[model samples]
Target: MPMSALRFAAVAALLGVALAPAAAQAHRSWLAPSATVLSGAQPWVTVDGAVSNTLFYADHVPMRLDGVKAVGPDGAPVAIQNGATGKYRSTFDVQLASPGTYKIANVSEGAMASYKQGGETKRWRGAVGQLATALPKDATDVQVTYSSRRVETFVTAGAPNTTALKPEGKGLELEPITHPNDLVASEKARFRLLTDGKPAAGVEVEIVLGGVRYREKGPELKVTTGADGVFEVSWPEAGLWWLEATVQGADASGARKSSGYVATLEVLPD
Candidate 1:
């Protein structure tokens, strides 16, 4: 393709990423631990990761496990060994030698796109695999927006601790209020969504449990965050849960951008 056409195509992709409706977007990728709480003498925990529309089901494309990291119960790095990427999902194991909360996190490299307008080009960056809508035809090149994303989940060894569940203040983060590792189907799980280290108000949150077939009556449950940046959800059934939030912003240039945040919770049977 010609240089101009190639540039246009790139810009179009960026716009799509910025404006795509929530319902049509791809599933937010996340990592779900096999067990959130380990008791007795177990020193190993496994995590499964995927980019599926549903929760925990590797029905969609597999997520890459290259940059996966695990922090042990003592606030130190845990060994993540034997990572395997399959056609539908990726799996890895963590060696938990102590008794505390473990944190597994992945921050993807930037995914970016740009377009030329009025003889100038603008660029955008978002969570990998985020899609944007087409740029408006009448809009000119006058702004730029950039975004970054990350995913996190926690596991408890021996006893539960909230230390590992604290927000890292990344692009978009969720601070567990109900202890992500201790969720129960009979109770509600509470979380606070934060953006740039401050309470994020009026952001939409979507929680998905297992695949569509696994849901009791629906696919995704949606809720909007209040002024406190907190939201809660009750699992209809015991299973893995995927929570996602997106925030959009624009640089001084007026270029619109967005970032995606994903977290997982393991809900046990009541």
Candidate 2:
């Protein structure tokens, strides 16, 4: 299966999975590394991948490794092996040699079905395979809208590199002002969220340290963008962190759609 196909599979599978207590507005894909900063004794690291509505939880389904790619510390291609897909998440291991930052990313893009009725518009919840068959047969205003998605994470061996974590100018991208791999729990970290290579204001960003989920009423895990589309948050502790943002816009077909971006940051202990 291809990257888009695998993502669709995970989305379609969500209809069958039990929903969490708090349902997210959209589904996000993520790549999380086992160790953000490797030591001399540790020669390898592992990554977990999944596409689900719930952040940091494999409640829906695991992501496929059909088109996964990893760049080593020295910007060389790293060979990923022993990839295994499970019911909830996918796991892969990467060997570490050089002493810098390693980046692992996944990209998925395809068309989505949308129903435009009057001023109100709604998008299909699942895969494109469930298009008209899963929707009402009498539906008249169905539009095939295009969408692109990308998710990435970083890990450092000895020192972190800012050049390696540069944004790829995707739909929703995070340009880290502070090094993602070298974040400390006591200090605040800043990031600029960009949409189509430009700063996006008023974007909803969810920052979670550890496994805590984002809630609208909670101030600790959620923050919105300002005029510069920049936000800073202090890490509660040192551990694995997940940051996700969502934005809605019209596709090339003039159909209203939504896209999400997820990035996993590993903060060192204070």
Task: After superposing candidate 2 on the true structure, give the runs of residues whose Cα lies further than 4 Å from its correct spot.
Answer: 1-29, 51-60, 74-76, 114-142, 212-220, 251-253
Q: lDDT tens digits, residues 223-256, model 2? A: 7888898998788777677777767678575765
lDDT of 1 by residue, 1-270 (tens): 113546644644333344653335665577878877888776788888887665567788777776688877556677788999989999998877778888898865444545566676655444444524444354454244455557788888888876666666766788778877788887987888888778889998888776456436455789998899998787888877777777877756564656667777778899
RMSD (Å) of each candidate, 1 decimal: 5.6, 7.0
Scored against the true structure, residue 230 in model 1 reaches a CA lDDT of 90
Best by lDDT: 1
User: Under the 3 Å rule for N, CA and C atoms, how many clashes does model 2 have?
Assistant: 0
lDDT of each: 0.71, 0.69
Q: In model 2, what lDDT does residue 229 have?
A: 82
Q: Which regions of candidate 1 deviate over 4 angstroms? A: 1-16, 21-23, 26-28, 109-143, 211-219, 251-255
